[model samples]
Target chain A: MIISAALLGVIAVILAWPFPLVLARSDWPARSPDVALVLWQTIALSGGMSMIGSLLLYGLVPFGNALPQSVIFLGDSLRSGTLPADTRFTHVLALGAAILLSTHLLLNLFATFVRAERQRRRHYTLIALLSDPLNGQPGMRVIDHPAPVAYCLPGAGHSATVLSKGLLRLLDADQVRAVIAHERAHLVQQHHLVLLAFKSWHSALPWFPIANRAENAVALLVEMIADDRARRDVDDRTLATAIALVGLGQQPEVLAAASDGESDEPWISSPERALVAPRVYRLMNQALPLSRLATMAVFVTAIALALAPAIVLLRA
Target chain B: MLRMANLGVLERLLMDVLWDSPTPLSANDLKDSLMRPGLATKPTKPLATTTVLTVLSRLETKGFVTRDRSVRPHTYTAVMTRATHTAELMHEVLGQVPDRQAALVRFIGGVTPQEADTLRQLLGVATTDNL
Candidate 1:
């Protein structure tokens, strides 16, 4: 049982730091964002599970070797409001940390969801009064503004893709369609739900640098996924052109980048520019589809990672 | 979908009429203006007074319009000019997400003029290749 606890702790640490760090630094994610996104999700899930499981394993070591038996025994002991004789202070401390971490993560998820829904409702209220529907387009609203603006407001039953008149003026008919296709891809794929998990994870562990890195990596991958989806309908060139035009063209006011001679990429200061460079790069140059073997390898590894914590505790 | 989007168009149209008016107008005045066809993506059917009232109430609640209850027939006036509302929306040209972004709002990256030139060159190159 102690060996099992030690093994779980090792898995947790690897998944939490070195694994995600290596993955983020690698260029493989840019090749097939769908596979990369799945791997990221599994890593996040298994990492949290193993971290809590390791502590719980230590806390229940005295109860039994098998997880089911140990969990039942722990439950019975809790119901009776007494600790067993073999229980050590280390076990109590570990148990407390595990419970606290789990509670923090769950509460943050709830908080993010509630907060997101409220904001969406308010945005909907404003859009309802301020926007006018496009005559031919369903599920899209056209706002009368001189600056090009476009985004999708994703909700459960209701979703809207908003475009400003300025954007319409700048884009030709095909480019306009391309832009709409891209926004529609985001809504249809339910990319917002994928983002919610990473968001809550980041909020729960704000102090952890790995948490921030993982969130950003996953965020970029989500965009790539939508881009790929959009490409299915519009040619790569058309979509790339649209992205470049919207991203790089004339703007009303832009925040001046605080230039320090040390940095190379000025776009890093602006979130919009950060998104544009890589997307344009990927789109302009063709992205070869990831090989089947590599894709399979990722899937296999992800599944194994997800099951590792449970298999180690239950059978070790 | 934009099931509520059509409603939005009606709201804006109603507000536009209010903004253009020299003074506060009753529901009938706005209704008569809207009842005419070709009001930019609005319905052509004759609007019910209750429907007009419902939209007015919504606009009033949203602070885009204010209604006076002193008269037999209540009158409503625009709270602010269209330019002011447009100006407010302009600040959010790239679409603003709330802090700790819950929704996945794709942003327009602010491209430096140099990079924009480089991208345009790249796009130009791609076009030549396609030709």
Candidate 2:
């Protein structure tokens, strides 16, 4: 029981702290976001499971012969309509804490999903009320907003890419196509669902640095993933310039990007300017393709990490 | 799968008719109004009443138009004033996810401060704090 508890503690600590710090600084995700995304998922899932599992195991430690025996005995005790009288106050508290934490995490996750889904439905309803179908463009809508904007609301059959009139007026034909390509990549790749998972994790472990880092990393990595997909058909320069033009055209207040070096905008406090600067930089100097061996290693590591909690629980 | 946004040209024309009308419009009334002279650009062919009904039903389902079933021909009225609906849609543009900076799929918008910093660091651009 002690061995399992210690292992769970170590695994939880690795996933919650050092792993995210290290992964956050690594440039590997830039080269291959999909693999890195998988790795982040492994850490998050396993980390959460181990945290709860370790607590439960600790709570059950004084009951039975071994870790599994204790768990079985604990289950039997609860099912038989009485908790063990031999349980200590600390043990009861630990068990109560375990149950509460697990429930809180699960409930928060569910609430996040419900909230996102509700917001999506409302957004779709609003879009239906105001947007007009773009002439000669199938599956695209033109909303008559002045500020430049383009985005896709993704649903299985209900997906629609929306471009504001300002956006169309601001960008030339190729730039418009590039922007559409980016939005299309999001729909094709189902990035929203990936984000939903990370978002739920962030909500569940609001104070954990790993949860925060995972949310940020997944958000940016998915953008890169979409950019990679967009660049396949669109020229890199065109895509980069399109991003710049849209970014610039939208924020009239941040006009200094024209004078200052492209990288300077990243230092600005405005969220939009900061996001655009790096994306522009990455497009200009694309990361080289990751080697097959490195890709395989990432996959292997992800699989092992993701399975760690399950393995520990099953072994007991 | 009828789209709520990107209303078809005919649908928009129907909406225009409903918006301008003081009273609820039946399908035949809508067709007559659309076919009238000097109403924006007309479709190549005259709109059939059945087409008008299809458009109205689609609009009704989308919550743009509410059907009045008490009358003989089943009159339809716009659920919301056009101006209010337009403003609401524009103000509530994108970012459907509940999480700030967590809506990874959105393009052409601002992210949260933390997301901005993380992205800046990843791209090797010196963030404000670093600068």
Candidate 3:
């Protein structure tokens, strides 16, 4: 029990701090966002598992040799008037906190899912009313808006890529095609689900730095991944140009803060702007893919991180 | 599935029928109108009244049509002129630009200084003609 408790502390500290910092600073992810996304998922899942496992362990410290025994000990203690002799006030607090925290995270995750789904359904209904099949484009919907917008409402068979009439008028043929390709990539790859998971985690633990950073990083990374896919058929310059045009019309206030790179302003402005710079730079410079070995190494590390807590718990 | 497009086939047919009528329509009236030759885009087979009822309810939900249950036979009427609905749909989508957090993400790409100037030039009042 002592050994497990010590190991949980070490794991918790790493997940809460250094791991997120190191991952944030790592530039290799830009080279392969897809592989990096996998790593991110592993980290998020394992990190969550470890968080819950650590709390469970802490709650069980005075009770028994392992989780099941500790749970039985807790039940017995509950029936009797007194807890185990070694069970201090802190243990009771830890036990209560562990239950509360686990429940909170689970409930938040469920709520986020329901919220996102409701929003998506509403969007779908509105699009059905407002959009028309693009003249010759089968899967596309032409909205009559004039803000140069383009996006895909992600779903299984129901997914539809939408473009504003203003967007059609603003860009040349190739640029328009690039916008289509980009949105198509989002639908084809189902990036929404990836984003949804990260979003739910962020909602669940908004105060946690690791969750906050993970959500931001994953959001940007998914865009890059979609950009990479669109780049397959479209030239980088056209796509970048399309991006610029569309991005310019977004929140002017947010963009103003973003353009002033030296501003000591709070990061309350949309992180999307910071993300845009690297994406444009990547498109312009054309970053090459990392070697196969390095990619494999990242994936291996991710798997190991995910499995580490489980192995520890089993051993205990 | 409920279709929502530029006056979806059913919506357009229903709208046209509603507009031409002097009073509100029952689902049977809509079905009869829809089944008339040369009235609908696809009038090949007559539609089920239930299908017509479902479409009317969807139209009501979308704020395109209104239901009146005060009478024995529940009747429906167009909530707005077709032009008005079209204009409103455009306006709603335009309103979505500032709130991209909901429906669309990544509609914008990185903008260079030159592109920003061009976009600024195009930022005049976006009328139907612009679309």
Candidate 4:
């Protein structure tokens, strides 16, 4: 029915809005040649899979039965001489569908907004506690908390960086600064917003393949971006050494700590941290060269791909 | 330095509401004002007073606003003026750019000719007055 289609269209549009914004704003490292190829292929595969699934489910299913039922309902209404057969039933169905989809989208948006608000509150509280102008650095506050934990809360202007007392005592000043710079970079580049938006997308549509892949890719890319920024402020050797030292310390509860042992799953651990430990272990760490041309090419390609669908839709 | 990255769109809108107001307003006042605008026709779910209070408290903790508890109902004021906050944001963003002039040029390139002329005229006055 027109109503149902309209409802679904609105929901889809609402869910898709965040994706474009995130792609535009993300400051992730340029996709390597291999990564770019993989991402493109993955997107194509997922889009194809979804297209096939939708066709099978919507096209091949009990679509004919529904048509008769709709016709019967229309006849019954027409027989009563109360409403037009054609428009009445169709409008009802459409309105019903629109209401259902709108409710679903609204609920999801509310939940995301609430979660984001809570995170903001926590971030602000941490900022208030760790704010020390005397330190004279644009980074997170390393508080003297009993437990070892690492997390970031985003802010508007100068976002607060927070670390526990355990972390401060565990690492030297340079090591601490390295960690701060890394976290600061995350804030500076607005990476958490990407994570938050992706999380909302996944929650809204758990079956979407692209959502999961995008989430994983974004997590890894953000860490790499932060590492790149941190390296600019600190020597590569110093950063590598700091990452190794932090990894070795191995706090049980801290999820953000850059250590394989800290996480139960080796695959999910921070890739930047993993790269650092091996190089620092052998004392052969060097600055990772960034290819500006490659970065620009990937950025342009992503923009083009993201726009292509919209352009087609608009033209249609 | 608080990063705006963490704040939700609603929170940002709420802050803007407060920032735009000429006088300190209570939570009820803000909720009422925001609702009065009728921006969206979708049935308005009235936000709870507690939610507004929580947002204000959070903003206070973030140093974006200050709360005056001396009155019967607490009133909040923005800690930094709009101009100062905007300037600080501009400074931070410009500092982050790899080439500040290039970034500025790109940004200015996007401005309308009339706007660019106005900016040029303003800059000329400031330059002459050394303000």
lDDT of each: 0.77, 0.73, 0.71, 0.48
By descending DockQ, how would the candidates be arranged? 1, 2, 3, 4
Per-residue accuracy of model 4 over B1-131 as CA lDDT, tens digit each: 22344234345546667777899888888777767765432114677777677777877776778888898688887776644453332222222222221111100011223333343444354346644
lDDT (10s digit) by residue, model 4, range A148-226: 3344556565466656555567667886777777777767667665555555656666786556655555554555557
**What value does the lDDT take at residue A304 in candidate 1?**
99
Q: Which of the predicted structures, 2 or 4, would earn the higher DockQ when compared with the native?
A: 2
> What would the per-residue lDDT of candidate 2 be over residues A37-60, giving only the tens digit for each residue?
888888888888898888877788
The candidate maximizing DockQ is 1
The clash number for model 1 is 2
lDDT score for residue A305 of model 2:
88
Fraction of native contacts under 8 Å reproduced by each candidate: 0.40, 0.26, 0.25, 0.00
Worst 10 residues of 1 chain A by lDDT: A254-263
Clashes of 4: 16
Interface RMSD of 3: 7.7
TM-score: model 3 vs. ground truth = 0.79
Expressed as tens digits, the lDDT of each residue in A100-179 for candidate 1 is 99999999999998888887776666666677778857678887765566788899876888888878887878878877
C-alpha DockQ for predicted model 4: 0.02
**Model 1 ranges off by over 4 Å:** A250-273, B1-13, B36-51, B68-74, B86-101, B107-121, B124-131
Q: Which candidate leads in TM-score? A: 1
After superposing candidate 3 on the true structure, give the runs of residues whose Cα lies further than 4 Å from its correct spot.
Answer: A79-82, A135-138, A251-273, B1-40, B46-51, B61-64, B68-105, B109-131
- Which residue pairs clash within candidate 1? A272-B109, A273-B109
DockQ of 1: 0.33
- TM-scores for all candidates? 0.84, 0.78, 0.79, 0.45
